[model samples]
Each structure stands twice: as C-alpha cells, then as structure tokens.
Target: MMNMAQARPIAPNSPSQKQKLPAPRRGLHLSPHMVDVAVQVAVVAALAGIWEFGARFGALNPFLLPPLSVVLGRIWEDLIAGTVPVDLGLTLYRALLGFAIGAVIGIPAGILMARSNVVRWFLDPLVSIGFPMPKIAFLPIFILWFDIYDTSKIIMVAFSCFFPIVAATYAGCSSLDKWPIWSARSFGAGERELLWEVYLPMAMPQILTGLQVALPVGMITTIVTEMLMGGRGVGGAMIMAGRFADSVGVFAGIVQIIILGFVVVKSVEMIRRRILIWHPESRR
Candidate 1:
C-alpha cells in the first residue's frame, strides 16, 4: 500500500460553493415565557414589599393607608362573606345588559353612517356633541326619566359606552382598503355579501378595540352611578364605608373595585387575544 495520506475532513457542504444548512433555525420556545413569569413575580414581590414597609413603619398612617393584610381581611369579611356578592352581581348584570344594548345600536348605527351619507349627516352632529360630554352629566336626566333605579343606572352605562364604540366602528368601515371593495363590486358581489364578508372581517380589529374601550367605560359608569346615587354595589359599599368613616371597610371596598377593574381588563384582553390572535400585539 502507498504511504497513507492524512485525510482532510470534508464539511457537510462545500466551503466555496456551499449550500447553507439554514444555521440551525431556532424554534419558538417557552424559555422566554418562564423568564417573563419570573420577572413578573419579582416585580409584584417588590411592590408588595414596599407597600408593607410603608404601612408598617408609619411612612403612611394605618388609618389612611392600612396594611394589605388588614384591607384583605376586611375584604374577606365583607365581600367573601356574602355582603358583596349580591351587589357585585347586580352591578355586573346591569353592566353586561347595558353594554349589550349599546352594541346593538352603536355598531349598526356606526355601519350605517360609514356606508351612507344620509346616515352620517343625521348622526354627525349628535355624535360630535355627545362624545365629548361625560355621560354622568346626564345622570340627572336619567334619574328624572327612569327614577333612581336599575333602569337609570343601566341606561347611564349603556350610553356612556356607546359613542366610543360607534366612532371606532365607523372609522374602521370608512378606512377599509378601497381596492377590496372595488374588486368585490367588479366580481359581482352583492352589497350584503360585501358588507358581511369584506367589511366586517376587516373592521373586526377596530370594532373590538372599540368594544374594549367601551367595556371599561361601562363598568366605570355603573360604579360611579352607584356611588353618586347610592345603590347595591361595591361603589355603594364604599360610600357607606365613607359615611361611617370605617377606614378598613373603605379600603377593602376600594381594593375590591381595583380588583374588579383588573379582572375586567384582563378578561377583555384575553377575549381580544383569542379573537384577534393574528394581531402582533396579541401574539406577543
């Protein structure tokens, strides 16, 4: 045998005339997710630590700024013990019903305006005038018309949440990619089909954004109505606590309101993600 030559290793692909192996493309992984969760936990712990320190060391007065434990205890006593369930239930019921009512009118009204000059002309003045004014300003009118009852409160929330949604929906419809409409028309699509298949789907993101905005407004209006007029809800409880100067109870009510608000926001966000999973923000 001839003297053995040291073998040179050949690369999986040629060095000069190489076909790339894609550099081992990274897959979607959950490691970043775990890190994010850890970071969130740390943040919460830090905030809680600061709050505890402030409350315990007299940086804040116990009466004015009670410890989280005390506030939570009060929440347990009043809310978890059954005092809040009925009131919260009623408030939510009204809020849901009111939002549903607003959606029925606001969405269709917005579409009509976007699609028809006649509808826009009729509605423009009202929307412009009403959108900026606080719905609470109409509280007196609601009271007078519906009598300081659930009807008044429901109406108040419904109207408060309506315009923003209607406006957003209108914007969505008006801002559609014009080419799609032209194409659909050229392709012999009926007006109804075009509206249903093209406009509605394209407008869904804006429409949902409006609904998200409206949802919080609806809840807030309900609480404010309850607070101002006195009714069965966390807001009423807060008012009652203030009337009695029960600091712990007041704090508890405020906490409950905050928690409720958070839950509402989170729920909206979850629904938004599910519906608009294609949205970049939702995907992240």
Candidate 2:
C-alpha cells in the first residue's frame, strides 16, 4: 500500500508499454515478379515502337523489314483463316514429341552411364565426338534415310536435343554425395528404392535444366527441317514468302516464331518452379 506520492507513473516509451507503428505502411509494394513483368513489357514495347517508327519513316527497308502493322494484319488474316493454327499445331507437336523422345532416351542413358562402368566406357567416346559435331549437318542424311517427311524432321529434332540432356543428367547424377546411398542401403533399401527415392529426386533439378536446354534445340530443329523439306509450318511459310517476296508473310512468320519461343520457354520455367517448390532456392 504505497502512498500516491511514492507510486511511480508508467513511462509511455517503456519496452513493454511502447506502441507499435503500423509496420511502416508497406503500401504500393511491388513484388519481384511484378518488377520482371514490368521490365519485359517496357523493353518489348520500346523495341516495337522503334521498329514501327523506323518502318513508317522509311528508315528501314519495307522489302526486308515490313511494318509491324502490316505483319500484324497478315498474322490476323492467317489466324482468322485458320491456316496459322494448323501450322502452329504441327510445329508444336513435332517439337514436343521430339523433346519427349529425347528426354526418355537421354535420362536413362545418362543414369546408366553415371551408375555403370560398362555403360560409361562404351558411351564416353561416342558422346564426346558426336556432341561437338554440328547436328544440322546430319539433316541431309536423315532426310535421305527417313524421306523428307515428318519422321525425318522429328528425328532431327530428337537428335539435336539428346546430347545436352544426357550430359546434364550425367553430371547431376555423378555429383551426388555417397552418404545417402550408404544410409539407404544400411536401412535395407533395394537398388530400385534407392534410385526412385534418392537418386532420381537428387538428379531432377539438373534433369529439368537439361530439358530446358534441349527444348529450344528441338524447336529450332523442327523449324529448320520444315524450311529445308518445304513442309507445313511457320518455317515453310517463311520459305514460300521468300520465293514470292512477300515481306508481310515472312514478318508474320517471324512474329509467330518469337511468340512461340517465348511462350514455350516461359511455360518450362513455370513448370520448373512448380516442381522445385521443395527446394530452398525456389522458396526464395
């Protein structure tokens, strides 16, 4: 029972008594994804504006470089007529099919190479020599063997995609630490269990990276084969446009290819992020 004069008043700024400022008002915050989108949009818009201005002012040659509006109009007409969609579907199918084939073959071969001395010895020399050879140089032989058709083109794409995937997957598999294998084996895990639960998961990130590397190669191979073989795709359209000197058609094909490549790469990145959600780097 202290008297009034002896009682100490509460200090407003004392540690436990202090008031919280409302988290410094984090208003109008832009996340990293927002920033990336904004930057990409700005860059693309700026480039398009420059191209349009140059074309309109005759600073750029209309024959080689059609105006953006003309290109867009051609693309719109093709889209409305449904020609572009068919060609797009064919191109996408070939690229994806080839990529799937490449991945199926490459991942297993790479894993085998990493795990088995016999496989590594048998494959090492061939992989070393073939990887550096320009894959496009083999196109004529493939065309002759498979007959200037979808088969040849798809095989070309697969051939172009395989080496990088194999290399990356092998590297990933070989880099794995041994402690996990020992632990799993000590716990009576079989070879299949170790591979499925430990090795594959550990190698997945690099395998996905290999797929990323392979995908663009597949797309490029498809387009090149279409051009060479005079077939149904944007590349074929470009070749025909070149013969007729239709700048608008050629530019439209170019624009379509740009859009396609961007979409494919972004989709792959999205998938990679989704699959890597368990990784600490992906959490950031």
Candidate 2, residue 153: how far the Cα is off, in Å? 0.5
The best candidate in terms of lDDT: 2
Model 2 / residue 205 / CA error / Å: 0.8
Off-target runs (Cα >4 Å) in candidate 1 are 1-41, 278-284
lDDT of 2 by residue, 134-230 (tens): 8999998997888877899899999989999999999999999999999999999998998999999999999999999999999998998888889
- lDDT for position 46 in model 2: 95
* Model 2 ranges off by over 4 Å: 1-7, 11-23
Q: What is the lDDT of residue 250 in candidate 1?
A: 82
Predicted structure 2: lDDT: 0.91
lDDT tens readout by residue for model 1, 32-147 = 86988789889988977777789989998988888888888877776657887887788788888899899989999999999999999999899999999978999999899888
